[model samples]
Target chain A: MLAVLVGSGAMAQEIPAEPAIETAPEPEPIPEPPPVLHPPRNIVAQDVPHDNGGVLNIQWEPPIEGVPVRYVLEMAGEDGFFQEVTRTALTQYTVMQLENFVPYRFRVAAVYEKGQSMSPETEPVMARDHWLKLGEMPVLIAIFVFGSLLLFFIQAARRGVELFVRRISGLTAVEDAIGRATEMGKPVLYVPGTSTIEDVATLASLNILGEVARRTVHYDVKIICPNKDPIVYTIAREIVKETYASEGRPDAFDPDSVFFMVPDQFAFAAGVDGIMVREQPATIFLMGMFWAESLIMAETGASTGAIQIAGTDSVAQLPFFITACDYTLIGEELYAASAYLGREPMLLGTLKAQDYGKLVFLIIMVVFTLISVFSGYDAASLVRVR
Target chain B: MKRRFPMTIMFLFAIWGGISVFVGKTKVHDFDNLLRNKLLLIVGAFAIILGLGSLIFHHTQKIKRKARFWQYSYVTLIALAVTTFIGLGGGVRGERSLPTIFGGTVIGAHDGLVYVFTSQAEKNLFMDEPSRYADPTKAVLELPREFETDFNRFEASQLREEIHLKHTALQLKGQPIPPMISPVSNQQVAYKKEFKISLQQLYEGILVPCGSTMFAMLAFYMCSAAYRAFRMRNLHAGVLLVAAFIVMLGQIPLATAFIPGLHELRQWILDVPNLASKRGIMIGVGLGASATSFKIILGIERAWLGGGE
Candidate 1:
């Protein structure tokens, strides 16, 4: 502001000397200087919530008129260490890295033409870390609700409660896919996904493979599972061996049935395609997570006139499998296939609990939608996940 | 307890992973980085080494037994062995110390012979000129001269060094025959690498071609599958055929140019029904995965531990 006055004074030198009319020299009364703007109102400082600590937030309401050119905020703690944190036009400032346990005061001032006004120092506030963050309330609610429902269903099943789940045709045809291979005197090819065992989709595939192996052992059908991940291949071998043994067909289990191919994505796909072309299997089961290779395996199987059954959690690959395979279990159907096939109470009860959780989620969504329509408040915003 | 032990570890680790997300930009972030980048690599390295070992053992057994297609096993084994040796000996970037077999004769780069060189401008490479030379030969450059006559890099390098030295000196003295011209810039400099069989060369020449060939096969498969799938066997197949036709046509600018609103229709179809269905499947998949994870964490699912055993 002082710079603005000095700039105006320099411009006076550019003007021609006021003519002799200035000789009249009638001295005039000096105009009064402009009034200074008042400082902001209702200054408050509080601890920033839902954090690990060492932060405080300060807010103030600007005066209705005569606003300042800018606002300056400062903070002070023990030892009277007051220092300007930052200067900005915003009405609120968050002072960070304050001493965790020490109280701190904040002052906000407004700068005007030639003067400034400072608000009274805010009541000292201390930053503290809370054990639990309130920002995660929605997440906590979801977990608690879903987990409780799951536990409840598990207890109910332990008490001999019966559960009913509609049959998924894709799983029902697992026997047909295996039996066709047996009748045709060809091996049943099973690719338990090209991904590592760490992926949940691959784990889901393994669970279904167990049931398929048991059925194959009972029917005396040959089942060959090729894997791309070494750990998955080893565990698949174990699962097949145990399946045959438990079904009293130990001799039927072949260790070479579940083998590891090269770990390269396209290499695995080419190897599997070669297996499809050469072996000409009666049926191929492609399950788990796949990328670009999904269609390669499925289309090769289709061309060989083999019955292809594919199930994967990869949404992008689902279209390819649906286009080329005889039966493609879409999305959640793949995950649910294991429980549907085995019908074990442990699996069935979880499916039941998941249905209940979905119901609650549906109700919540419906309620939020209606509230937003009638009350004009976005209730769904309360459930922001991240 | 055999099953419970791994489950307990998984549960604790999952909980810690969840908690780490909320800590947000704190010291825990450093720990997360350490675990993800360092610890995971340590574990993955062992898994990969064991996997390679198994691959070697598997192929050798196939060869010993004379299994069907056993000849292909030899190819895989030889390729694996050669690549491993080359990768370990000739480093990924060819930085490993293997003795240079050929003389270090770089064709374009400075190799101790000089002739009149081109500076592209008068007097010097930069700044104002001292004086314009009527005959550029009077300047007498001290830099590497470009090979104006066609000379094979391999052939030239094999020639005796004295031949190039004697010829370069004569050319610098303004001899009418065998004119020496220098490259205008670095872009014009052409040099053959000293080592021919580099790791990157093998990867680009062999691995990339094979991978690309496999990926290219998808084009044929896609066409054949489309033929079978769009058979018009039912209403659903007919709908798919029509939708596929429009989407494919909309992708071509010529088709959309003939139909003014075709692009808008394509965008609406993608952004509306296609995205809606995709997101719907995503949500269902998410829920199923969540349920499955919970089952695994609570020990309700145990097939991963070798079935019911």
Candidate 2:
């Protein structure tokens, strides 16, 4: 019985030791020491000027060790303690607004989840406030060229130098259209367009109107103007009156013919259409800054069997005018038409100078296109060398 | 001589106004209060009278002569009388009250005009079925009764009807319903019609009709005008004819489709030779305009201001 009691006590002690052993299984195999991360390679630095004094640019390639790694770009000043600029998965970083003309040392380190490896510091790049230095030369060159051209033209115009101007088909047709109306014994309808007087297009229209008035006075043709702007209406009456007086036909001029239509665009268009349909004008002159109403007006004139001559600077709407009108002035040509018809010396000189400017533009475009084409072929090699 | 001196002064003022941009450094904020000042309000009030006067003079002449489409004059006269009566009869602190019947009528008409011409017109013309009203006659009959309830209630009910119609139409047309309400009104109202007509309405109702009519009318006028003007019995006319034919055919889609080369040719004409010529002309125009502007600024181009020789 004493022997049995001692065996029972030893068995209980062995059972407790077995429970402790079962609680802790083999420890995780020490996690394989996590693949060693090499530092980022070929670090480079450059100076960039910005509004503030706390930025720099750092660039580097991924580590050659072929491990997945991110980079941390760190910058330091003369104080020597590095502050992280950016933590990025990218190979490039632009450190911005660094202290002006101050030296900054930047380095990149490769990091894995386990640990980080250091890269060699890039050559110290100075932050500069001299940003204007880069852009100044090109801007100066452009200003000089543009200013000189402007001055030359102005001086030439002031000196009364004769400038050659090309004839616009639409302007040339103006007198003919008016004459045709005179022959048909029908009134001429002139719409200065639907834009407000503040628009430059309206000014061009007025200039053209002066020419049309001059012709109408000479031919003794009745000209009816339907205007959208009250200001334009007032101006039209004055212009027409002056033209008639200048042509020695002031008595023949009818102030009532210059009428003010509604201020609304569509209302004005409808009113003008009513005039076209009712009056059946032998000729219609649509000159000004027109919108979608251009096609409507042109088409209405076409239907009325009027000799339509439309001129506008709206490029998108030019196609409709071209299709419907006898002669259409495209874009800048409207401006040119007025100048040609007006025959003012200042205008002629400016026209000649602008032609030379356009020639310069054409040459530049051609050279740039050719260079772009040639450079595209070997761009990869050039990029590698850089 | 008295008129001439004041006119000259006004001309000088205008010239100064054009050059004010170069001379003055005033910020837009400085002008904001001045834009809404009492003097400007007075001037605008007078300007409105002038506008009404012009409209009256024009329609009166048409009415007197019994001109073509003279019947339209009645509509113009009635519109003018109603607008003038509303505008002139009402005042802020006068015999007429701020919320006078005339004033309210004017405001209601303006708002109603936009809704009818914009929303209802589209529903009437383009919609497959009237969605808001299962029966439009019922909605029409209810309109007068709702309007008689109270001014505010009437406006609210009318607005609701517009909303219902707009939403239902959009739903029927398989379009998403648009949320419509006055920004001043806090209520979030879903409209029956999705399309709110604006410039598109003007395009459809006015510009399209005018343009199509103008285009068709030109054909008849051109026939007569061409018979007289296009006698290509001269060198200049011959050149014009050729140029016209080239441009006309070049612009048409049918020509471009049939002859692929014509498209390139047209582009060349527009971009190269045409652009070059146009530029040459523009330079002249720019110079002329600059000179004219300079003259105006210096009070030389005084003809516009009705001054000078």
Best by the TM-score measure = 1
Off by over 4 Å in 2: A1-160, A245-253, A374-386, B1-49, B83-309
User: Per-residue lDDT of A230-257 in model 2, one digit per residue for the tens?
Assistant: 7677677788887787777779988668
Query: Which stretch of 10 consecutive residues in model 2 chain A shows the poorest summed lDDT?
Result: A377-386
Off by over 4 Å in 1: A1-48, A51-133, A248-253, B18-37, B99-193, B196-198, B252-261
**Top candidate by DockQ:** 1
> On residues B1-309, what C-alpha lDDT tens digit does candidate 1 reach at each position?
866787788788667666765664345656767776687677667766766766777678778888678788899889988887778776653446542332222222222232121221211321232222222322222223443222223223323343455556767987643443432222222122233234664676677789999999989888887888889999999988888788888999999999999999888888898898897788667767877878877777777666565
lDDT of 1: 0.75
In model 1, how large is the Cα lDDT of residue A263? 87
Instruction: Please state the CAPRI-style docking class of candidate 2.
Output: incorrect
How good is the docking of model 1, by CAPRI class?
Answer: acceptable
State in Å the error of residue A123, model 2. 27
Q: RMSD in angstroms, all models?
A: 11.7, 13.8
Candidate 2 lDDT over B134-234, as tens digits, reads 33311212222212222222343465565466556667999754343222221222222122223334345555675576556545645554454446878
Least accurate stretch of 10 residues (summed lDDT) in model 2 chain B?
A: B102-111
